[model samples]
Target chain A: MTQVSTTISKEKCFEQLLLGKTVKRVPGQYLSGSEGWLEAVRAEALENARALNFPSDRHDDWRFTDLSPLFQHGFQPVSSFAKLTPGDIEKFLIPGSTRLVFVDGCYDAGLSELGFSGSAGAHGVTVSSLVERIGDVQVETYFARQASFKQDAFAALNTRFFEDGAFVHVTGEAAAPIHILHVATRREAPSAIYPRCLVVMEPDSRATVVEDYAGLEDGVNFSDAVTEVVLKDDAQLQHVRVQRDEKNAFHIGHCSVAVGRGSVYAATSLAFGARVSRHDLHAVQMGEGAEIRLNGLALITGRQIADTHTRIDHAFPRGKSVQLHKCIADGAAHAIFNGKVIVHPGAAGTDSSQSSRNLLLSGKARIDTQPQLEIFNDDVKCKHGATVGQIDADSLFFLRSRGFSEERARNLLSHAFAAEIIIKIPVPSLVESLSRTILDRMSGVRT
Target chain B: MINKDSRVLLEVRNLRAEVVVDGVRGVEILKGVDLTVRAGEVHAIMGVNGSGKSTFSKVLAGHPEYTVTGGTATFEGRDLLALAAEERARAGLFLAFQYPVEIPGVSNSALLRLAYNTLQNERGLEELDPLEFEDLVLEKIKVVEMDASFLDRSVNEGFSGGEKKRNEILQMAVLEPRLAILDETDSGLDIDALRIVANGVNSLLTADNAVVMVTHYQRLLNYIVPDYVHVMDGGRIVRTGGKELALELEARGYDWVRAAA
Candidate 1:
């Protein structure tokens, strides 16, 4: 293996990169005199990002995933927005949805359909660009509050440089699901884009949102995104995130959610593309009687790599959490999953369970799964399990004896392994589309 | 019942086989066994445990774990040992497993439909689509006394012992094989399940097909009466007789047969 070591440390390299990339603009008015606060937050985040070192193999969380392939390229920021027509993005659109489309980190108002207005104190819902809603107090209070950029380098970079992204605020029942689509157009040089989103759901409101990331062409690009979600008391939200970038792209995503009292939050994330990708998710129950369900699936082939790290924190009494994560790796691809559930002291009657299941299709395919649980109170109920294995021989033979060819049987079993998670996506259209994608991708899994 | 003019379906002569462990052959299990069966007939092979009754059925189905050292077994005048397990199934041979494996993701209806369609396509017959196949499988599922929900669930993933055995019979009904080998299909079944499975097998029998059941007890025979009973001991059949022989063995036990052999 070729070594990518350099005399200049990764921290210094990124510090110089950040120094040259930081930009300050005359910001829009938000809640009267909010411009100074935004700049201050940006500056402090940039400084914090510069002070921290890029994760190396020595880091406990970064031991299995080597970022040398991503760090080797010095990706430049996308200088110009690539022009795209309505037909160009027609395939990613979901029926009965209000859309917010962003091309290369820049919001395209012409391509977006906002069913609700951005006026202050909107009653029902508001789905618009983040930069346009700077006047809302909810945006100011919850924008960078939930997901801390102080320790995470990628989140800090996204906070410092993101120009515009989707902003969804729900005060009542939403009539249609909101779809936030981010597309990366191929460029001649290696480019980088930062995508940001903030969602605030008030008490007694309900809604569903989908965060979709896609690429137009197969080339090297970097997408660092951060999303903060706050579910207030008695609120319900279903979030589905799909990442299907190009084969050579690099993606890093961070999503932090705060669950309030009597609220329910459910998220399903699917990862299917990118040469190297990583996602970090954190959900904390801030009040009593909160519930959260997290489901994830990662399917990769060839030389791709996917890593997921998730933490669910139960801070109060009577919180419930259930999580399931699965990975299917074929060829020489690698997959990693680390799930942690922490029940703090005084959080009695907390019910939590987690399971991680992995499948390797080839002799060289690899998977590393870790399920961790920490219960400080004896009154809590928590359980976790991890399993890694290949196909069952007896099952294979049974199928063959029923006249199914070996290839067809293998494909059927693998597809069934992934359909368990894919079937849980709330949207019927997205579920069908993703099922087709998985079927097409799994056909190449056979040796 | 066997007709004198019925065509021969399976013929075995001086067959010898053994289990393979890590590519090495173990002790011989089926030592020079011989048997013959014709269409429209049901035969029962009775023996004590480890007498190679189950091994004989698996070896006939071309299970990879067991290797045939020397054998001459023909199915419908074709060398059965020369075909792959799947090819044998396509040529109309079915083995109801003793311990049916649970497939977690593949649905029962899906597997049955695929198996049925594959056989149909191989025979140059019309294949059914999903809707048509569902209709056909729903009809076949009733033969085993299984409800429609069994079609939607994973293939015997969480099924009970009896449910798994019935699932095997369900597959047999859908494939409609010409020669069916029931290997201890009644081992784990209750009294009701045994009758249901036996009745299912009885209903599927026709003038062109035959059933070979391997069981230790004669209780299953009360429902699906066998036309012939063969006593196997020490890896070979020592005696062959009519249905009364089964009742005699149940009364006298295997000690008499061993002493006579």
Candidate 2:
């Protein structure tokens, strides 16, 4: 057993659960209606899970963020949705919108529209729990395509334990985005949750998927999430994830996407909570003429830490990608960003640009960023840059001279620095909501 | 708006100040400087380079780097030095900075709205909506013949020197303060831009308000004539006279004033 952060031993944590030589599907899941091929796939996933290893600091991908704290707690899979009554999920819910709600790691049939009769069926969208939809036609093939448990150990861990998550298949175009809320309910024993989401868009279709994670602010919890997205030819998808987890919570989530030929994938991930969290976004342009935009913001304060690592690979010619991620850390906080764009050997005429900017509002606050471009094709145009600094002194004084208080001036300039990326979100209410969150976090923050 | 006994818009008495370096040592800039300006007047303080003219304007705005060792500044009989910089600005004192800052992401319209709304809140007046504010800002933008798109761009970012000066006047127009201190507002402006800025200042001048122009040249006086011109040397206002003093100081350089003093 590997012993780290807390007094609890690794045996007292995930050793017996995730590190087992041979893993089974979570003890009690709703997998009754599965057939031969789907059952065979599940058994194969379990075999793959058994061969996986936990990520450690020694690994290049996990070097910056430490998961020792996560390995110090004993967690159980939330077998059913009967753990807690659905009470606070309404506050996080967008009014009059179709959504799927998960408690701990299980989907609450009472709280989710997927369980209702013809709820989202008439809207040209299919919504269901992956447990029940494993044998269905649209979802059976797209489950493990993008986020390969065979490669990512954490994803392998989630695939072994995750029971219920949102399964959304959008036809033509969704009338309204399907919102997925993964709410965590803590117990006496420290709990770990693996939230999963699979969004598959049909050819020539368009849709949006919002994955929001919420939990008690002071609770001891852990969530490692995996979301796999597939955009078929000429399909467009806008995926937004809001992470406002518990303060003592440890969250490490990854979103893997495969952009089809001439398809567009736009994503924005806002990280505003957790003790230590890092979001990984890996997008691969699998076909020609694909376009992708990945933008994110992480706000950290106190002793908190947030980091984001993004990689966009141009595999075919005429692929385009734009990446911008920002981090604002105050107090004794730490924020890190590493964004890389790769142009393959034959992927000529590929245009890519990536920028990673950070704002340090306190002397003790730190930021580390590396924006890299690795291009093999000479004809491709690729650019990457990184910057880290404090607010402009002259701008602050200028605002103050115009009748803004010192605090107000700093907040306005800080907000402007963040809005350079936050305003790009297409949802109006979500933009306003996230703006208020950023402002509230920015209140009383100074350099 | 000037009536009998309109008001004493600004009065400075025996102002002594210095720039505190590293928060310890002090370099004396304004030594025993005394000045006064009433409503319905434009006072031009002419000085050679490094005569502490800019320091005096900044000190009035409560710049933190400047320390007022001994002095009292009054605006409408209220002690200005006792208030914070924003409070001083709210009390109708506006300083047109010599070097306007270029804030990359903040738009000009947003900056003007915040300043205008804050002033309205200070004075207990009704704030205008966005459309009304746009109309008001547009009306003021014409004073400098500024392009309408200037309001849409980031504040002062990438603006040419002439455009920056005109932007300062445009801000003065949007925020109609009682005392508008133009610190080198004429510097770096072309002849055409100088005329537009001078004309904007002339159009905004009211008998109930005042203007203070700190300049090194007499050319600006040719456009917006000053009622009084004060010569500053060795951190003191050694001489004061009518607008003719500006021409005299121009024809006969500031060396004559220092030699006579």
* RMSD after Cα superposition, model 2: 4.8
The lDDT leader among the candidates is 1
* Residues B183-223, model 2: lDDT tens digits: 99999989999999999999999887899999989999999
* Per-residue C-alpha lDDT of model 1 across residues A1-447, encoded as one tens digit per residue: 221233344554475458435223324412133478788888888887777657769888879897778876766676666778998888888888888988877788777777554454464788888888776688888889977799888888888888787889999988778899999888766677888999899999998999999997777788999999999999999999999998988999999999999899999998899999999999999899999999999999999899999999999999999999999999999999999899999789999999999989899999999888988999988889999988766677787788876777777778878888887888899987887888787663221
Q: Where does candidate 2 clash, by residue pair? A: none
Residue pairs whose backbone atoms clash in candidate 1: A30-A135, A31-A135
On a 0 to 1 DockQ scale, where is model 2? 0.47
The TM-score, computed over Cα atoms with residue i paired to residue i, of candidate 2 is 0.85
Worst 10 residues of 2 chain A by lDDT: A19-28
Per the 3 Å backbone cut-off, how many clashing residue pairs does candidate 1 have? Answer: 2
lDDT at residue A353 of model 1 (Cα atoms): 92
Task: Estimate the TM-score of every prediction.
Answer: 0.92, 0.85
User: Which candidate wins on DockQ?
Assistant: 1
- Across A179-297, the per-residue lDDT of candidate 2 in tens digits comes to 89888766554566888898888788887788999884356767879998988899999888899897888888988899999999999988888888989899999899999999889
What does the lDDT read for residue A63 in candidate 2?
Answer: 78
